[model samples]
Target: MKRTTIHISAALALLLGLAACTQDEAGFLPEGAEGTPIVFTATGLNPAATAAAGTRAPVDGNWEGVSLVGVLIGGTVKAYDVTPTTADNTSATLTSTDPHYWTNHDDITVTAWWPYTEGETTPPAVVVRADQSSPTDFEGSDFISAENQPVSYGNPTLRFTHRTARVTVVLTDYTEGMASVKLTGLSTENGNPAEIAPYDKGGDTYTALVAPQSVATGTAFITCAFTNGKVFVYKMKEATDWQAGEEYTYTVSLAAAKDPGYTVSEDGKTYEVYNAEGLKNIAELVNEEWKLGINITLTADIDLKGIDWTPIGKDNNKAYTGTFDGGGKTITGLTVTGSNKYAGLFGRIGSGGTVKNVVLEGVQITSDNSSGYASGVAGNSWGTIENCSVSGSVSGSFSVGGVVGYQFGGSITGCSSSASVKGTQRAGGVAGTTNSGATLTACYATGDVTVENDGTSYAWAGGIVGTNGGNSILACYAAGNVSGKGSGTIYVGGVVGENYATVTACYWSGLPDNDNGGATKVDGTNVTWQTAVAAMNAALSGKGWQYELKDGNSLPALKKEQ
Candidate 1:
């Protein structure tokens, strides 16, 4: 929020050196243009904002050193101290928690060096105002707001007009929360703009075009809706020349979550509309990530069989319907895995949805290649998980929980884990890491969470969770052995790795062991394994339930030991 006006060599040189120069110098400013501020104005059917790590603008554009001071969204005015990327050329750019900036959505103005102007000794600024002259406003609505559109094939198709362009963004295996609707633009020459698309493809990636004539040369905007009603902007430059009647191919690929719209059958079993007939199996699951509506009560314990289920994440091509309840069923003896990320009950259960009475056993999960935050129950939980258990290993780089990893704001109640969580970094028992707005309750762990060998030792491994954001953890415990030291640092705890969340009536007793380069000593106070087992039995008895410790047994008992 504070601006530091520094007299850098460029600024000082431009001010002092230009003063001594005459109009004869080529790089010198034009005599009459000295007082006129070099101002830039942009207007178009701005696309909805997209995640920065994903796509840029529909046309090729960059905001390398542009200054964006403000952005306007739904009539609300916000301010920004730094620059925002406006590359998509769609409508508005969607902002993510990453990059940390782009969350504000008011008018953007900056005082940095102009993006395209080379050696121009003038200050640059961007000004935006709603086009009152245009009758039809695609300003507030996302792209897929229109119905009965055409389906896409492998690539995105484009249609052009003098003032507008329509692109049908095609994405295969579009899942819940993992939809891909990215179209950015950049100026081919000096006067162009960059932005992220601003429309929603109704969770499907389709073609949407931008009127390059309506946008500047190097600005992009994403016109999609994010969770917190914020607009993310980017700076882009025209990368190619798109002439009228000339067709050029632009590929936009994103890794998003899957959308599962499961319905209950007459036989009390839940079934998903598997896939469209004749659709090539590019992904294991179609649409975005699978989400449940309410609680999916499973009266019977069923096997998932040998189905290669789909994975999902929190991207454009991901979707979730409601809560998926296993209804006290033993969800075991099956092999399920996804490409992006997958949850047991729902992909993203919002800040509601309670997942209880389920057991995830003998499940094998592969690691997410790029963005981490994969979990056994859900990707990034914001609800309550109770009376559940997980017994499989999860591998990813960041944001992983045994029962639930990367909780934003939720509760993990009465759950336990006996799985091995392996990741390149940031691994935890209950949650890999948590924000300051989450709560954990009545949870325990006995897993061996470790980090793989990497060059640097900067890992954040722990027993319960790698880190916590001020929440409540009542009657919870952890006993996992945290290890790995290649670029990893031990933050292990008997109950939690780092407890910003409250731990009441909880304790830890797992053996603290580490391998080479790891801190051999455990981080928490000694609670002893026997005490931990007794506490587990006592909690189960009080709840009229039973539990089994990780003692060598082919078939673990469910009843509490006498």
Candidate 2:
């Protein structure tokens, strides 16, 4: 690392008169301020001590036609040619035909790079050489204006550090017949200098500018060529955070490539080897393992028909605490016909869990237990669900919904459900019940909610939520027909059967069919189908909701759903 100082000052009152009279078309300082020059003093510990002698030498007289310094002001950068004033090349003055100067009060940033073009403002990509004989060298530094204090006469110093890291791969204890090896999986392109490193090859070792962040956990491919004309492929696992100006080395032994066998192509020109077992299916994942804090990406849409399905987190006490990224894939033909208490793909979602980018299509979930929960996604949720949708049928005895049976505490955003929900006690198109700490935003439901109960049992059905216990519901709407049939007190509403929560910017359309004997009411705005659509569009658009008009649909659906 090296440190430098840049001095910018205005002359005394005597020179102000001259500066005011020298204003130019390029927006230089006024005439009287002309003599006040911006000076740059280079001073710092050498960054590359082991490099060649002239590598860290200052670019003084040699920088005549090159951009030695760049001044960034108001989001625009202006390069300036440098003219050394001293013999040591420690101090230099900026020279420009248009008098390129900045005011002392103007906040600006300065960057210094070697071998830069005359008018180039953006950093150039450091070229990478695949051959071990040739290698490219690149470096850059930046200084912000606010970090340094401005003086009327003195210069404010700045520090510069190497913006790239080095990585080396060592082959240890290799077989005698191994002739060649190649590594892949490292990123080779990045525009942000601080986040990603440009690729550079140096034979067995690679040196490049890499982002100072944690490297994602994955397998790196290693292809080896043998002297006997046989080729073998191996995968080396790597996980670490690469630091700037730091060197990392990885050692791999050839004996680690244990496998069933390698497959040969019909052409006999290529040999393919399987690294590890492929991703497990939904049923296999539920029966064999539980993933916590790990990300599960579904590679393809799953069909769970005619399979003995056990809900995740049901057999084991451990709840789902990892992230399930469906990658816009749907799980269709899901049939849960058990008498379990919690019946869904996920029995319960614990805190810090996330389920996103998934859709449950044509699912048929039913719980025969007298007091149980069933839904298309999760039976009970205390985590986050985003950009998810459900379209199916869910039936249970107690709590049942299209998306979630019970939202204990968490957030549900950009989600919708069109699954018909039926329950003996509590049923809703979106959620059967939501706690006070739960938040629902940009969610909607269009499925009909029905509550079938005996004369003595209580029934509640709603378009969105059967019961809201002081939860926050924002930017949500429902158009489902809610119905309740029972002798006991039945509550039915267009939006919520029982409201004891905060509902904002929510609307409901289509009145409930049968309202039985209970103190039930629609909490949000109740309007006709057309008026509800218009009002919802206006309100949601004002709140920056991304929506699109579907063919033959009165209201716009969320862009994420589409």
Task: Quote the RMSD, in angstroms, for model 1.
Answer: 28.6
- The C-alpha lDDT values of all candidates are 0.47, 0.61
Q: Which stretch of 10 consecutive residues in model 2 shows the poorest summed lDDT?
A: 140-149
Model 1, residue 517: distance off in Å is 22
Per-residue CA lDDT of model 1 for 379-486, tens digit only, reads: 666666677788877777666667766777766766778878876656777777777577665666778887653645456666777766647665466656676556
**Model 2 off-target regions past 4 Å?**
1-290, 455-457, 513-534, 537-544, 551-553
Overall local distance difference test of candidate 1? 0.47
Query: Which candidate's TM-score is highest?
Result: 2
Give the Å error, residue 171, model 2: 35
How well is each residue in 1-562 modelled by candidate 2, as lDDT tens digits?
Answer: 1222222223355467666665443255553565444555543323333133322221111222334555433444555566654554434455545433545435445555443455756544443333322222223321112112232324533333333445555555545565566544545454333222223334334333343446566544445566867676555465676554455666556553323223434753222222112222332343465544455666566666665456765533656777777778777776778797878877777889888887888888999988888888888888987888998899998889888888889978788998899998888788888885898778889888898877667778878788776367776777778888767888887777777777766666546743321222333345444454455556566554554545534654876422
